[model samples]
Target: MKPVNIGFNNMVMDERIVAIINPDSAPSRRLREEAKLENRLIDATLGKKTKTLIITDSNHVIMSAINPETISLRIGKGE
Candidate 1:
């Protein structure tokens, strides 16, 4: 699987990613809360401000400090 860097030395399987969302949205906040409740949340922000919410195919939610657009570009570049 291709891995995409999400910043702070974090990388996620590109193919496993289902969606890249802005964390500021109400729906995204709700999703994060639900993911936390289910214990499927992965905090990859490394204490930095969360800029993006990455939803994986396995129902895992990943918080990243990197922007969604940048992450999307990385995926497109196969990085």
Candidate 2:
């Protein structure tokens, strides 16, 4: 599977990603919390603040320091 670099050398399977969302939304925050509670939150931000929330097909929420718009653009480039 093609990989999308989410920053700090962290990568996620492109095809497995369901949505790339900003963390500012109410629903997005709730989803992140739920993922944390469920132990399905993947923190790829290292020590930086999370800017994007990558929801995967397996209900996993991958947190990244990169902006959502930048990440979405990276998706189309197929790196």
Candidate 3:
């Protein structure tokens, strides 16, 4: 991924910035297993409250879960 320029309006000095980058690697068996478990949980729960974000590298390898709902809430608050 690339650092997206947000123009000068909101730009400020000394502000921390974050970026997401993907690399080349195959999905690990452990990740596949976890996803399968999560899927089963969702299915068993009948999608009562299910949210999963599996961000993988360029080669579809699971890197790490950034954040779940807290991140969503932060973005929502920013908006």
Top candidate, metric lDDT: 1
* Worst-scoring 10-residue span by lDDT in model 1: 6-15
lDDT of 1 by residue, 1-79 (tens): 9989999788998989999999998999999999999999999988999999999999999999998999999999998
Give the residue spans of candidate 2 off by over 4 A. none
List the RMSD of every prediction in angstroms. 0.7, 0.7, 13.0
- Model 3 segments beyond 4 Å from truth? 1-66
Clashing residue pairs for model 3: none
Q: Which portions of model 1 miss their true places by more than 4 Å?
A: none
Per residue, candidate 2 scores C-alpha lDDT tens digits across 1-79 of 8999999989898999999999998999999999999999999999899999999999999999999988988999996
Candidate maximizing TM-score:
1
Alpha-carbon deviation at 24 in model 1, angstroms:
0.7
Native-referenced Cα lDDT, model 1: 0.94
- Native-to-model Cα distance after best TM-score fit, residue 73 in candidate 1, in Å: 0.5
TM-score of 1: 0.96
Which residue window of length 10 is worst by lDDT in model 3? Answer: 6-15
Better of 1 and 3 by lDDT: 1
